[model samples]
Target: MFIKGVKILFVVLLFYLMTSTSTTPLEAYEETSPARRLHKAHALCTLNKSPPATDDNDNEQIVETFIRCMATKMGLWTDKDGYNAKQVAKFFNKHNYENEVMTIVDYCNHQHQQTNLDLWAYESYRCATEGRIGAWLEEYYMLSLKL
Candidate 1:
């Protein structure tokens, strides 16, 4: 009888663990990320401030829309595979995805939020003199300014 009880408990524990597992690992990790979206209606804008809305999914336009939508301040929306602040850190630390990260940062900072964007801009400015977000802006405030 005791053995049967132990087996039942173990089965229950295993079931609980299985149920807790998520199908979309990307969605699970970004459930509560501090990102937001920033974009203008009608005319989409890329992180580089280029005119947006191309057929290409990875084109500047789509990226601009995604970043603007998920920016921290706007809190408008987010997607499972969209960019975020973590990606910015990765780009800065590893020089990986530099263009994508910079564009996303500029897209968000320019339209939606400020403070965190500012911090990232500072970091971006110090790291590279000719990268996406920091270097692409027209003036110091536009590029370096966070909010």
Candidate 2:
């Protein structure tokens, strides 16, 4: 009889342990979801400037859109119009910038620490506009990797 009582108590304790292991409300509230962070970043970006005027032949607008899309592809923005890595690679291939794009992808993917998304977005835009992405890719990789 005592052994059976112990077994029942053990089962009750186990059940209590399992059921009470859920996160506290404070913990749940403190942790921001990745999707929410992405949305906030996108909102901040949009609030910083007016939308660029659209023109089919406007090279500057085209490049700006491409950079912003790249930021989204890097998981830094919530914009629906952004390209993924594969699409960005295709774009680079079409523009004959495939090698530079490859370098950028490798650097961004393999860095030891997280890159500052805002700084990266800004630097990428600068490099894209200056037609010096290859150099910027190398520099960014070195700086980010501390190598």
Candidate 3:
């Protein structure tokens, strides 16, 4: 009976955590912390390194074309170059995902205005870390095509 009560308590706590997840990284951090946000981004990027989703008209022919398509998922889906990783990376950098992460980290260290609900978006700025995001995405898409 004691074990059953503990199990029920654990389930209730887990549900609260999941439902309480913030809509933004900062908001999430406000409830949690910046370290958690970074960990989340890092996890997301790493997970994305796997194969991507497929479209209806996709062909199983050339590997390069398919790979490029998957790599472009992080893109705005409106570029003329189609699946250009360079352009996508540029867009984020110029706009600000990395900056958002840095800002969060800054707040985490300095205790400034900390909230994932800031006006800016992490996806707004392209990644500025040596093509890390783009490369990971490209590689993942390529692998996905093979299987």
**C-alpha lDDT of all candidate models, in order:** 0.36, 0.41, 0.33
Largest TM-score belongs to which candidate?
2
Model 3: per-residue Cα lDDT over 1-147, one tens digit each = 344334333432332343234344444454333234333443444453435428422212112232223233334222332223333334346345655545433333233222331101121212222244434434543543454
Q: lDDT per residue, candidate 2, 1-147, as tens digits?
A: 344334333432332333244233223432354323333434454455445546533433433444454356345333332223444455335357766675665445433122444334433434332335444434433443442
Ranking by lDDT: 2, 1, 3
Q: What is the TM-score of each candidate against the true structure?
A: 0.19, 0.28, 0.20
Candidate 1 local lDDT, 6-65, one digit each (tens)? 433343233223323424333344444421111121123223344543644334233333
After superposition, the stretches of candidate 1 with alpha carbons farther than 4 Å from their true spots are 1-58, 72-147
Alpha-carbon RMSD to native, per candidate: 21.2, 23.1, 19.6
TM-score between model 2 and native:
0.28
- Candidate 1: lDDT of 36? 14
The TM-score, computed over Cα atoms with residue i paired to residue i, of candidate 1 is 0.19
How does model 2 fare in lDDT? 0.41
Better of 1 and 2 by lDDT: 2
